[model samples]
Target chain A: MMRNMQRPMDAMGRDELRLWIQQLQFTMRDLALYLDTHPEDANAHRCYLDALQRWKQALAAYKERFGIQFQEQVCDHTDWSAWVSTPWPWEKGEN
Target chain B: MWQYQKALQYPVKIKQPNAKLAKMVITQLGGPDGELGASMRYLNQRYTMPLRELSGLLTDIGTEELSHMEIVSALVYQLTKGLTPEQLEAQGFAPYFVDHTTGIYPVAASGVPFSAEVFQSTGDAIADLHEDLGAEQKARKTYDNILRLADDPDVRDVIRFLRAREIVHYQRFGEGMRLLQDKLAASSPWPKNPYAFNPSFDHECWKHKGRKEK
Candidate 1:
């Protein structure tokens, strides 16, 4: 389950890469709810940690390729236009 | 304290723009049992929870509902994108289009604006958790109604995801209720009368310091 993080980012298309990140996020979120009630479940805790690590890596790679998703991610030299110029999520073909 | 994540929790890539469908789907974003109410109900109710675990559960579920709100907004936005005034009117979206003009507004399908009156934060542990459980089922039923009417696969796919989440949340809230009940039972003078006092307001039950006995 963890090996996907080792796969080369370039191997997947933009949409595929985004989908991968979304899947990792879903895993983390679902695990989070389970852990909230069953905080003593060690197996779920491990899975949450694994998902968190993969989600972070995949998100970083996505930002590097597709520009920043959040304003704080703006680089010192990078213009703010880069953030506004990208298509909003609701726009067709942007997701 | 929350930072924005400029992405949908789930991907919504609706290919067709249908004003008619947008009208109905917008309800989940603003209707009485909508995502907006779901988020507010849990977040507001968390403050007075007697158990730490219950508070944590409310916070998590509340945050997820915010994400769900974004998803529903994206669906409405995508559905209404690029629709002409004539097209909108033909599809009975004119009432919304007149006031908001394709801009997303929180309103029921009947064009009633969103209101806080839809939910409650009674500050009682058992009551609030029961409300949450019912709220989840109501939201789930709304999604089911949407699925029954929605013909577009793209729209139904996203609706199904949101509906499934409601069921999961319902299950979690039920567990949270059990947790609260167990704590109350342990501390109650009479286990059968746990409802005799609100655990949230009766801080003495939990033995918090800095309070003078009356």
Candidate 2:
């Protein structure tokens, strides 16, 4: 039940939303590694699926509000400048 | 086949520029037990793995190592950013500054460039898995050493994350080794001697016997 609780994404700021998306991404990545070795683990598989779904939603929200994080997401928008103008991950106060 | 992701796997926003710390952390990027070597080792070795699961594990872990490489590069970049030449000289970063000028070049803190000699891709599954296990411990130990010398909380926080990943990878590789052994044990004529032959190279013999059994 606790796992099912959703964060209020609409009320969150840009940085907060980005951090939430990162947490979800980390969950998905760790779960994927576990599932790779324990292919038959139903619970882990379930968690992976949930994380993936949340990650997609969070990423979409982030992209629509901020900008695309990957080249593949470029097709969703016409302005390529938004992709280039944003600060890179290594830059201070960017990521 | 890998696509570029504009964001880092983890965030790195080091406030203070410490050239000295950057020198030490650069080792994780290009040192003997660095993430670059770790990625190359697993990716290359995956080709010769006897089992699908082992190959998949290698691919996933190897991909993660690439992200780790980026994280290290970002750490080094932030650590060395915006330092004056005099400040760099005083911090013992002059040698690296002369060559790279704050550019993220893959070289050990000792100035040795990265080399393929850091890892091996033996066609033998047992040997390769052992190499991976050893590699993970070595990387973890290097992170421990960095943690010992590094004083900045910001740098250490990222280092700790990278160090923890090595432990997880070690566990996965251990599982992968066990999976390989079980498969080899079942397929071997001498069930007690799984090491009797290289499953990667002797696939024809295994296939013929497997076909006969069917």
Candidate 3:
């Protein structure tokens, strides 16, 4: 089962990727919504900071388990090809 | 400081998948105006942004696109499961099976793997913002197409959610773009960042000490 897991940036076997993404997604969503209503909420602002930190941690874990990767290149040249050199998104063990 | 609500983080709880719908969504996955490109464009473009709110918007929205990719994959996985060869040939999924074998891939709906040329970071604020606007519209249209093409109620529900999110993202980016355009006339207080995501001026508390550029 572990052998089958091969996708990068998604962190195989942890199942943390999906849940973490969902959590952060929800965090930002609610933050956006509430901040809309209560722009002055100091607590919400602090939460945003914490949420962003959590988000970075999730990104780090994903990068650590899989490798640093990007969805697209800003530089026209793939001169920084190393970023895209890893496995593709559909490879097994990546879910 | 961005406080978060746990419930809204990953509100999509189901793991439903539909093949035809998946195919259309893949257009946004690997297609020119797809989610992958949008995500990449915004995430990478943030470094050069002059505003805090706009940068935050890009980071959050770009990150959400990653989930959109996963949602499509989940749908594809559910749709392609337990298929027979005959079904494969009839449904036009055979060629893909040969390449990926029921796997979720970052390919165009036509079956090509993702390409790096999908997104751009020109470093010019007006150009990138225009691109962001167009990108959101393209994604919205793709979702609209998915809504038209998908027959399954399950798939339609998710498509509706996805479609709505695109509109929201468009509004967010549009607002951020306007904010930048207005700020351009003033002296560059936060550096001439074309990718800054904050449309709101509340970055004083949310920004990190080390990460703050100015």
How do the candidates rank by lDDT, highest first?
Answer: 2, 1, 3
Better of 1 and 3 by TM-score: 1
Better of 1 and 2 by DockQ: 2
Q: Each candidate: what lDDT?
A: 0.85, 0.85, 0.62
- CAPRI-style quality class for the chain A–B interface of candidate 1: medium
Candidate rank order under DockQ: 2, 1, 3
What TM-score does the predicted chain A of each candidate obtain versus native chain A?
A: 0.75, 0.80, 0.55
User: Candidate 1's interface RMSD, please?
Assistant: 1.6
Model 3 chain B is weakest, by summed lDDT over 10 consecutive residues, at B3-12
Question: Model 3 segments beyond 4 Å from truth?
Answer: A1-27, A33-95, B1-18, B188-214
In terms of lDDT, model 1 sits at 0.85
- Each prediction's fraction of true contacts recovered: 0.66, 0.74, 0.07
Off by over 4 Å in 1: A1-8, A64-66, A70-81, B204-214
Give lDDT for model 2.
0.85
Tens-place lDDT per residue, model 2, A25-87, is 777777777777899999998888888887787777877877676454576356567777777
- lDDT per residue for candidate 3 within B1-214, as digits (tens), equals 3332222222333344345555666676677777787788888887766566666777777777876776666556656666676776677777777877776678888777788787788655566778888888888887887777777776677678778877877777777766665555233344455235332333432233334344
**Decoy 3 TM-score against native:** 0.61
